[model samples]
Target: MLASLITFFLIGLVALVVLGVVLAIVGAVFSAVLGLAGFVLFKVVPVVLLGYVIVRFLAPKEKRLAQMERKLLETD
Candidate 1:
């Protein structure tokens, strides 16, 4: 009866270890995903938007004026 109880305790301990390892792995994956999303939001998106603004400003004035004219006509 003592041996049976020891075996049961060992099984429970092993199961708890397995659960801890699984949770650690899942937490690491979740952290990595959140880090990647944050990098994209703070770094990539702003750089892309800045590049777009730069390109828009660098465009010819005639094209910009035409766009403004079209917008004015649309509003009218």
Candidate 2:
């Protein structure tokens, strides 16, 4: 009986360890997804916005853009 109890305890311990490993894997995957999303929003978005801003300012303004800027300034 004592040997059976010991075997049972060992099996329970092994199950717990397996569960811990599965949970860890899930957490890691979610964390990686969040990290990628954050990098796209924080790093890539700004780089794209900066490039657009420079192009908009340096290139010749179309009549529409000029009119919008004028309206914005008037509002201010």
Candidate 3:
């Protein structure tokens, strides 16, 4: 009976250790993923959005200028 109780205790201890290691690995991976997501959100996304806004704001003016240039050329 004592031997069986000792064996059960060892098994339980090993199971707990394995569970702790698995949780640690999972937590590390989750932290890395969260950090990368934050970098994209805070850094990359805003730069891309600013570029998009600049392009959108300039495109119509460029088109209008091209049209005026064409008209001037035709008049010449």
Which candidate has the highest TM-score of all?
3
Which residues of candidate 1, in runs, are more than 4 Å off?
Answer: 61-76
Q: How many clashes (backbone N, Cα, C below 3 Å) per candidate?
A: 0, 0, 0
lDDT (Cα, tens digit) per residue for candidate 1, span 1-76: 9999999999999999999999999999999999999999999999999999999899999999999999999998
Q: Write the per-residue lDDT of candidate 2 for residues 1-76, one digit (tens) a residue.
A: 9999999999999999999999999999999999999999999999999999988778766865898889999999
TM-score of each: 0.71, 0.60, 0.76
Alpha-carbon local distance difference test for all models:
0.99, 0.95, 0.96
Ranking by TM-score: 3, 1, 2
Clashing pairs in 3: none
Model 1 residue 43 lDDT?
Answer: 96
lDDT of 1: 0.99
Clashes of 3: 0
Task: Score candidate 2 by TM-score against the native.
Answer: 0.60
Q: Which of the two candidates, 1 or 2, achieves a greater TM-score against the reference?
A: 1
Candidate 1 TM-score, true structure as reference: 0.71
